[model samples]
Target: MSEKKFQTVQLTLEQSVESRTKLIQGAINRAAHTAGVVSLAGKGVYVIDGLLMKSGVTLDVQAGVTLMGSGNEDKYHHRPGPFELLRNQTPICALIFGNQCDNCVISGKGTISGNYRCFIKANQEQAAHIESHHYPRPEMIYLQDSRNVTVEGLTIIDSPFWTIHLAGCQQVKLANLTINNEVRMPNTDGIDLDRCQYVVVQGCKISTGDDGICLKCTEETKRFGDCTDIEVTDCQIHSQSAAFKVGSSSFGNFLSVKVVRLLIVNSNRGLAFQLRDGGLARNFQFSDVKISTRDFSEEWWGNAEPIYITFVARDHETVIKPDDGIENVQFSNINANSPTGALIYSDVAGRIKNIRFVQTQLWITTEVGKMRHYDLRPSEKRQSLIMPVSGLVGRVKQNQQAGLSVMYRSNEDQPD
Candidate 1:
């Protein structure tokens, strides 16, 4: 059956953050039983707090409007228990929580600003000491367990944490998004697809401090663990961390993920897989990528490797199972300029298997002050290992068949 659309509810509110919060939440409550459109119109910044989405609702942030997220701690709702990234007393939440809402949309040509300036602790970014607000930072958009969601054409800015997080969502599409966070800010990931299935992200221009496009199977979303059948294409991304990555958390299985036509520039790492929590990542294809990486401040993870795929235990004593690995991964038609080459490593034999690189060209940029360490951070005491820079460097366990199909070009003529 077709959706029974309700009349448009145009929100008119005062400048106070509390008023906007009340009005927005009231509109959602009023539309709970039926499908509706909550339109934020006009050409001014509306101080918005936590707004929970409802099913079949569309949040129409109009062309000239802006939703400015309030930084006050008490204005928004938060989780009862502390998250792993937060202090024990700090609360975790999002500015817009689309929890279990199906057929919802957040589409606009306007902007959504997280107003991270109010949350900045100290403006410092260098050598693993980026000053951050460890206290009560919230994500920008947390769409949890929702299906048939579409977020497009919005200019999302200065997110204190992850900008667009689709946690356990199905059949979603994100397109034409312009996301820009402070490049030196910590943990401001552009878009994170956590335990989601059947998602497509295309035509996004994202520049952020952390990973531009990341896939995660975190412990929080363990119940919905099959993060598979996703595609990201035609995106221009830049980040202090990996432009495209899967991890820092891989507790759940991932399969059939494809990323193509990526323009990655000035990122710390071009592509990566940080399988820390020991899950299988397989049947992935990365193609038609133009990547340029440079060494950034040690404050972030990554060390300029154009292709970094590592399957190592997070801790020394943490034992990895025999099947915990990345397998059947292919990289095709990739051209990269970076200070370091690709690093594919696995702690056990056959753990990293069936890798293919076809028409992969590399131009190793000059390494003046860049670190020569393969950093596997969020691990045990020894987080990094000093290594010689080389083209397509890998370290599988001794006597393991690499199962390689290689076409790599070093000293390739780089494009202007």
Candidate 2:
């Protein structure tokens, strides 16, 4: 790795405790033009109201420098009226935001604390008011329309919402990040890549209440382009939801994606591909993945399945115009132990085709408890087609049938 010298500035907030937020933001603003490093030194607690990073700046929190959020909702700024029709429809005011910036980095062996629990009462009350407007929760880091970004070696804790959100970004790299949010904190996804391309996430340890590492393409993101050419490898993930997922918001294509060498433990679901919206999710590859899934409450999205791939309308009532379905996916060297087996379901109009599972060992531990079988059901009154599964090591256990369950529903056929 080549090293580049950076003009550095050290910030001390102990002297002016009352103006700590202003001092930090001003330092970052000054560093943007100089391509400099703003180092938060010493063991002082620097409470930041919010930070909007400029291009070509590096916020380096040195060891023992703790940047804590003020935890005051009034201090944060929300994006005005019009909101994007994506997951987390509520526009959140974030702790650190990078908007359409380039060549930025947030790195160092320090802590960025969200202090999320301090607003539990407020979050609960806001949630209770269902008819009211969407509440503005604060994410730890929200980078939108940015390029050439790198976030490395940060210990992020107690995030209020999606911990690291990358929207409409390109050529981003996230490595060696240790993100630990409270298990009870809802919607605290570890790393969310929304309509991001040419991204690489590796050597990260993420444990959160929601999905660990997820790729989403919403309607707003689709306007930019498809999310393509992403890679995630060598990560330890534990989540109440799926450890690694493509989408619950797939409005655009997810192409040329790859995930390898993942250790997923104690997650609700191991791997999931949810293509509800009209999109094409294809040319995906997953290899050398070891997964352990357990049952969680229904309030969560998954059911402890080792692998799940489904295609359905976004809503049952609304009609979803099916585009190119999920196709040309490959999973190899996957060893999973779960209460439920793999589920690959596709509707009649959109079929999941050419799915190959090579050297995959999925052991359903029914002795632990009564578990559900692999469900391959299409929509109502639709003929279900059986796509071939090659090199499947484990059997689908349902109705005492042990081996493979590759059967098609024929309109003219009745069992003899």
**Number of clashing residue pairs, candidate 2:** 0
How many clashing pairs in candidate 1? 2
**Which parts of model 2 have CA positions greater than 4 angstroms off?**
1-18, 81-89, 122-136, 316-319, 367-416
Residue range 1-416, candidate 2, lDDT tens digits: 22433544455765453387777777888787677778777776677787888888898888888888888756765554223454445556788888887999999999999887765654454341112123446878988889999999999998877899888999999999999987666778899999999999999999988889999986766556888999999999999888998877777889999999999988988988876665788899999999888876655677777788777666554245445578888888888776556776755443677777777776655433233433322233332333333212133212122322323222234122
Q: How accurate is candidate 1 locally (lDDT)?
A: 0.80
Candidate 1 residue lDDT tens string, 305-404: 8989888777665546667789888888888887777888766567887777777777776443344788888777558877766676776534222432
TM-score of 1: 0.90
The lDDT of model 2 is 0.74
Each prediction's RMSD over C-alphas, in Å, is 3.6, 8.0
